[model samples]
Target: MNHWNSGTAAALLSAILMGGSAAVFTTMPAYAQETVKLELWSRQDPSGPLRAGNVVKAAERLNKELEAEGSPKRVEVAVRESPAKGFDDDALQLLKVFGIDQGPDMFIAAHEWVCAFQEDGFLLKLDDYIAKYPQHFGTIFPSLWSSAKCPDGTYAIPQDAEARMFFYNKKLLREAGYDDAFVDALPERALSGDLTMDELIDIAKQVVDKTKAKYGILHRPNKGPDYIMAFNAYGNDFVDPASGNLLLERDKLAAAFGWFERAVKEGVIPANNTAMEFDALRKEFYTGNAAFWMYGIWDLGSVAFPTYGLPKDEKGFFADWGWIAGPAAAKGGSPVSLTHPIVYAISASTKEPELAVRLLGHASAADLNTDHAVTTTHIGIKPEQLEDPRYAEAWPLAKATELLKITKFLPNNAQFGELNGIIYAAIQGIESGRLSADDAAEFVIDEASASLEDVVVK
Candidate 1:
């Protein structure tokens, strides 16, 4: 038989024997009579083909284990992969169009979407499901429980968590005469939550002066979601949940923006930040042209050391890099970093919501989820998962964990995207010398409040 025909026949056989959807049969054997099929959806990564492969393997392994144990219900998993085109805005629009029934059974989504989806009645309330199934819910972290919880107290289960930090070149530091002692002291200082915006700028200048690198910090000043990290670090809460009033914390923002403007004016930062794509900025860091890069831990596995089309032991790419938690607003202030928790939520219209919940639980088991966490270097929701040897095996986990403890989530309100855009434009203006720091701060507050006035925060 031809490959296509044989594959089709296998799918049909399994579906017939299990009496479930064709999607279920494709991922499992026919002998599992009570198999449940789950359709998962995620945005495809252009650079990382292994993401889909890993999810498949995770499901396949769970199926085999269930079969061996003679479990009554088997999991049949299928993924509907789509390109990650327009960030969360596009994803939200797509979810709205798909509604509850036609959407995937369970899919990965940003934490911010949970509140909006719950309010729209598009998501199933997992609290009862979690309460009944202790094994699955117990695996998640405590902070996630709160972050994923909606104002109405219904929400999705967190799948993975991520936090940002400063990526520095250790070798470059050494070249600049910063010995191991100085490098080792960074984390403690960062953890103390005292590093102010001005201190960060001074340190960047020191690194540039000492290393003679092209620039001290390679920062992308576009109005993307990434800038939320910087804004949060400065104590600016962009969205007020209670009133849905966009609050820019103008004083704090002005200080932070002034710091950036001064850095560019002093030549410590690249003047081309306004035009730099994330990829281009990363390339500059990877190639050793920049001393510091602020990015999430997710990039460590893929970009830090490109495995393909490069020497096996590519040294300079990330050799000089060491990580430090993002600097805080003031000495002794709470060190804040941004996190966008990725979660698994069931469609309210799913034919088998219970079955979807089970599959999601299986996927989140410490053993299975750890692999993805290690691969992506994401902070897992489960505390025990943090202790997994796999996490210890990866350096990014240690750094991410420390930062995750102090991290804060962006407001989950639907208008978050619009609020972010206003903030971004203001930051761009400040960086480009089009607006003074004080003016930029006022602009962000005035514009964001006007744009998001209709979004009821409660």
Candidate 2:
């Protein structure tokens, strides 16, 4: 899409040479003013519209700075919307867009895909920019910066993140004969690794047997990040640290798949879980027909509280609903949680990389980010965002932040999406009774080795 105003774009090149003091430019003519149109490619995700919208809003903030600095230029953001179904598909489409040299000035993407873009020379290296703009990025949590980095250096800005956990219905636990204290202690127990994966399934089993819940536990029906926490808990990181290659340990894969196998065999998870509609799965969990839903923090604002009339207040919500980290694979082992960050990256070919960086810097401002976080139930990238009253009011963000201490990210490897697809298929095979857990693990190993380059199998 042509995102620039007519004739204004032609003036952009000359304005760089025509730089003058504010007194000089302001006195000359309004016609002398230049507009730098920074086109942004963004997926039309209703859950996080502000992912792109905030960048557009930041143009106002950036233009004001430009004026104060006595520049003749003003920045305008043009958003090119993508109709992809999810981030994976959107990422693939973006790769082709960049391949043809039709990429936008900037784009929002899954953090995992930053390296993929970097590999193809499509991304601007942001290390220098990030260091120079201390005011913009100085207060962001140090931990999150890792998500925006590649093997060489930083390549993108972390936009937002959310915690993934097992959201359990406290009411169902109580109905299953658990006391309030017992139910409340579950999250702490999980954090300390006093709770194990088998214990979680057993608790779900109890809820199924003693309560009217039709399903004891449920997860997303499609390929996504939530279920990766289970694999992480079972010790499948999917990457070799020393070589940076995709790693698949057959036994570790089997252990994680075995959890799913046992859940289905014990009737905790439905046999056709992988085939169910997304809405139907959410309905079962939100409507109290399921005891536990494996999902993320955003579901509260995006689905549970708004769509299902869940308690909005902290105390009210905790009384009947709560969440726990993915329990440790064994007692005394580390628990796991996943935070899949969405990030912003500048195109390598953008005419105005500095302006694009500044624009995203303003977008990453604590207050502006808090607006996105509180409204969409996502965790903020900056520690300063915690000071915002609106952020404090969104208790789920604060509560979920506790899990970040132990959270893991999907590996930033370029081939991870393909590997995850294979792992997902193995899960489907196990759950559908087409393969045993051991067979599922073998399936993942064979499929990944064949489809992906440099896969390390053990």
Candidate 3:
């Protein structure tokens, strides 16, 4: 519920003046030391709280530390205003701002776009500062560092990440004739590699036949990176190990599309899935009209239960819902959930880079980030963040933190956008029964070549 506004200074000064002795107020200069402004930009979240709330909290923390340390400089935060829109739309607007040489001091964005920003030289290389300030940068999970780096250098500090999984309605499955024990063992079956993709879909098929639910399984309505994990669960490697380029293995294409094909044919998935908005898909799962829903963990806590008017208590929210890391595509194959961070990247164009890093260091502290994590449905970025009492008390954050260890990541390539577009389009075609998996595979290959040109390695 914290917000950054233009009146923060006035409020701060009023609180200080009211609390202090009259003698101190008279002795202190009528105008205190100059305050350096830290401008930050993060996409406006749809619910719960602002994404930049912690950054403002961090600046407040840093100000206290600065005064205690006898430093003259004081830092205040300014959150740049932008249209309240989806992630990509806000990102494009930032890019347009950057075009006119007017980027913010720091910005928060999806790690997938880091590569594109680095290529454009829009990001500040943080190698020196990260080395000097080891406490802040040194402790990040090793896997996540890849997202902050390119062949040139490390450019950002990761904020937080979530485990993307498929959520199923336990009550609906029970009504659909699945015994309680079978329903309880679903995730274990998935983790131990006993559940295969076909069996997973078959379970949904049974639900459809026995229950009156409108759909058996549902996924994100639009094109993005989530389905890549499903394919990874099917034992498909999307990136070439040697070259680090995006790879499309034609052989596994059939199994990938086969899942959607079967879902549509069995009436488990609605034929008009792509036509639905995110809100409608969420309402479908919340209303118990769909047996399963797949999306990031953010929705489970931040958007679905509270904002959608479903339920808030853990029992009321999850009593009927269970989550799996999306069952493996085949028995003995690895089940996977995707994890990617939204990172804080400094603009290369900023005049006060050191001050920006200082602010970020304070902002990214465990206690400070806990403010954002507890309300936003995001898991802590560092292992130690799990120990924070606030993060520990939040049921959703506690349950999701452990799953971060088993999560997969998208390849760190700039062409990933082009690759995802082709694949998502092909998925739409295959799910609609308009393209066979083989045909979709070929179409992806052609589109990747044309769109990606020399970047894709087939």
Tens-digit lDDT track for model 3 on 1-458? 12335365445334433432211001122234866776787665644233577777777767777787777877877776454355565566566566556667898887767766777678899989988987776776666676677666788888877788888889889998888899889887877778877787778888888888888888887877777777777656666655556777776766687778878888888888988988898888888788888787778666776676756666775667778877777678777888878889899988788878987987778776777777777877777877888777777777767667667877666567768888889889977889887888888888887777454443
TM-score for every candidate vs. truth?
0.79, 0.86, 0.80
Runs with alpha carbons beyond 4 Å of true place in candidate 1: 1-38, 44-78, 83-90, 98-101, 171-180, 243-246, 277-280, 287-289, 307-320, 386-389, 453-458
What does candidate 2's lDDT look like per residue over 1-458, in tens digits? 22455354445323422332111111112332888878888877888988988887888888888888898988877777777778877788778667656678999999888888988898999999999999999877777787888877899999998899999999999999999999999999999999999999999999999999999999999998899999999999887876667889989999999999999999999989999999999999999999899999988887888899999999999989999999999999999999989999999999999999999999998988998998778899888887788988988998898787888888888799888898899889988999999999998888888889999998
Write candidate 1's Cα lDDT for 1-458 as tens digits: 11235555555334322422222224676677786777776655543333334445556766776777777777767766554453484366445445423456766677777777776667788888998888878757666665677666757887778877777777676777777877657767777876665676677777788766777777665655555666677776655556433455668778777777787877777767867877788877766667777777777777665632322242433344566777777788766666777777787877788767766766677876677777666777777776777776665665476666777777776677777777677767766779888898778667765665653221
Candidate 3: worst 10 consecutive residues by lDDT?
Answer: 21-30
lDDT of each: 0.67, 0.87, 0.74
Report the CA-based lDDT of candidate 2 relative to the real structure. 0.87
Q: Alpha-carbon error at 23 in model 3, in Å?
A: 34
* Models sorted by lDDT, best on top: 2, 3, 1
Superposed Cα deviation of residue 298, candidate 1 (Å): 3.1
Which residue pairs in candidate 3 have backbone atoms (N, alpha carbon, C) closer than 3 angstroms, thus clashing? none
Root-mean-square deviation (CA) per prediction? 7.5, 6.8, 8.1
